[model samples]
Target: MIASYEMKHQVPYYECDATGHQTLAMLFRLLILASEDHSDALGVGTAKIKEYDGGWVIINYAGDVDRLPRENETVTIKTYVEAYNRFFVVRTFEVYDADGKQLVKVKGMFAFMNLTTRKVASIPEPLIVPYQSEESRRLPKVARPQLMANDLAWERLDYRVRFFDIDLNNHVNNAVYFDWLLDPLGGEFLRHHRLVNLKMKYDHEVRAGEKVDSQFIKIEEKNQIITHHQIQCQGKIAAEAEFEWKLV
Candidate 1:
């Protein structure tokens, strides 16, 4: 059986929103940190992977959030290898509140990439050997999210990718995408709506100094709301996302 890794964190004020709830960006940052720690423990940290000319890139995130932890709440973060193929690995993450209640669950799909060529590459044995996850030729795919209706009016905002947006590997990190995706929604809309489900896919990497156009459309249904977002750079989509929210 594949063993899981766990870490604990105390939600600090900076990671929380003005209302004292954990921000979605910070929640994901916590997951990424936990995963990195897991890799360090497994002996194949970033430096080790670079020895094989490979870099881990997360391409998809599918998840649901029960609630965001409040500021100062202690939470447990855990992740385990779910499955893998010749080219991809899926890892599952969960966060539990102080009372042990599940607060968030996410499945992240990762691809081993050639850092030089910036292309997806075959999984290296040294990398897969440690996980011991079930190997499959065909892994289930995340559903294609409901698309935004182009006929309807949409809101857009533009951001210049700053140097800080790039990670050590010189690629845009995950947190900046959240800022681009949700910033178009005015505070009045965001403060009253709570995200419940989300599906996001990263298709292209946005580098430093690039201009990104973020577009979002809101669809309202009975007591629930759905938002479709597209992050495009130079007319090519860098990321696509769909989020479900409920009015509080």
Candidate 2:
């Protein structure tokens, strides 16, 4: 079994939401940071992967959140490579409060992309061996985002992909999609709702200067509110996501 790596962090005001708790975007970034640090520890960091003309790209993220950590609240993050196949890897992250309560649990599917061609590539042994993750021929299927029940109600917003959105590998960072996905809900709904769960998938890359259409619709039920989002660029679906929320 592969060993898990952990780090502690104190929430900062800059990463928090209006409610003082960390925003979902920040939460996602923390997970990325944890994974990067872990990769460095195992000698398979981004710099090393770049040497092979490739970079890791997130394909999907599915998770549950009990609550978000507030400003100045310290939390522990643990992450590890869970499994891998010929072309994909599965990793998980767990966040805990000072009291040892699990605050967030997330699992992500990732694939390696050839930097030169921007196409999916087979996993490199140098990158996967150090992590000691179990090599499997098959992996479990992740939940997919569902179509909006009512398309006419979707609120749409148009955004131009910014230069800053592109990372070192010349693609929009996956974390940035959280902003595009959530912003369509408007400030009023965002401030009043707390995210409890999320399921997001990337179907295509959104390159710089491309115009993207972010659309979503909210479905409120007795127990929870559900929002389905889709991002389109160049006349194709770039991504899709669904989020579960409760009133704050």
Candidate 3:
């Protein structure tokens, strides 16, 4: 097993919403910071990755935020290698109370890219060696995303695409998907239950001119929630997603 890397942080004022809990955006920031610390620990920091003519970028992710850290509460984040396949490496992260009960788990899919060419490349030998040397790591083993088996039902909420939603990519950034997925649930769902986990699949690209529809479904029997979101053009699924949320 790879040695666990730990990072300590206090929830910052800007990170919390008006209700004094960490916001979804802030949760992403915490993962990014923890990822950086993990890279730095491995001697494969960003600079070194770039020096080798490649860098890693997130292609996909599944995260479960169990509890929101209150403002000023110090928490610890621990991360480790879970497992990897030829094209992608999977890593896991857990956020915990200072006393160590896990509050969140994040699993990421990463691809090595030749930054100059903006294309996927083989993970460099130096980088792969150390990570692979450790005991094999695998993803959290969450259930597979359910493709719409039939004419599934969904509650729709139409949202306007704004300039703020557009990122440097000149399109709605991938991270923005979480907001669209979560928003239809309203504030109460977000506030009361921790997000146990989620899965997002991007079937089509979302552009600025398009208005998107957010859809939601609750599976009470499984104590799980799933959403089938799409940006329709002439009535076709533009992007499809099935998120799994377990109540804390």
Candidate 4:
């Protein structure tokens, strides 16, 4: 059996931002879809997870984008299980253009959680064995995003958890967090810049009817702009992210 899986996709207009290129959030969504496809091929996908009453949750994700796919462009996404421990699995992804030039590289860490308790659970052997991934004492890790200081003058926006934002898991979908994080930057900034690198840590989940406050602080370094974001629910942090953007 092949250790990796790949899929071809055409960049859709709805997935692109004002810059006419795929948004960072859409890239993340695509990576997730690819992972789901891989898991389904291995016989351990959504249906199996439901049978186990467990779901996979991303603990952290980090990626670097060399180029963003433009609207209507055809691209390929390749993904594989990099490594796994007793509690967490590490997966990696690469996006390539039609010419085979890589556009993005991504790494994600995920843990299985029991739906009832919402706590980490041991991965089933049957599920783990199918991936044929390496078992390691130390799996790859992404740095946790730091909290934005209260003293910093940060821009903030509030969003209600809409029905559309909820996924099958019944919580705000992880991909929606990217919109909450970047939309506060406004169209002007997004039009003039492109996301180059991003790292995010999900600390808490936002449920429907909850109001989430998205805040961020921008730091200019050399030719790049780095932004730190914090999403809070009821004054408690739900997620944190760090983004690096380059001038267009």
Pick by lDDT: which candidate is best? 4
Ranking by lDDT: 4, 2, 1, 3
The per-candidate count of clashes, in order, stands at 0, 0, 4, 0
Write down the worst ten-residue block by lDDT for model 2.
Answer: 142-151
Q: Please tell me which model should have the higher TM-score, number 1 or number 2.
A: 1
Which model scores highest in TM-score?
4
Q: What is the C-alpha RMSD of each candidate to the true structure, in Å?
A: 1.4, 1.8, 3.8, 1.4
Q: Give the alpha carbon lDDT tens digit for every residue of 46-128 in model 2.
A: 88998999988888999899998899999999999899998999999999999999999989999999989989999889889
Residue-level lDDT tens digits of model 1 in 84-194: 899999889999987899999989899999988989999888887777678877876654456666667878999998888898767788878988898898788888888
- Where model 4 places Cα greater than 4 Å from the true spot, the runs are none
CA shift at 23, candidate 3, in angstroms?
2.5
Q: What stretches of model 3 exceed 4 Å from their correct place? A: 1-3, 51-53, 63-65, 114-119, 130-143, 160-163, 166-173, 202-211, 222-248
TM-score versus the correct structure, for each prediction: 0.95, 0.93, 0.75, 0.96
lDDT against true structure, model 1:
0.87
Q: Sorted by TM-score, highest first, which candidate order results?
A: 4, 1, 2, 3
Residue-wise C-alpha lDDT for candidate 4, range 134-239, written one tens digit per residue = 8889887766676668899989999999999998778999999999999999999988887888899999999999999999999997776899999999889899
Q: After superposition, how far is residue 54 of candidate 2 from its true place, in Å?
A: 1.6
Better of 2 and 4 by TM-score: 4
Candidate 1 residues lying further than 4 Å off, grouped into runs, are 149-151
Ranked by TM-score, the better of candidates 1 and 3 is 1
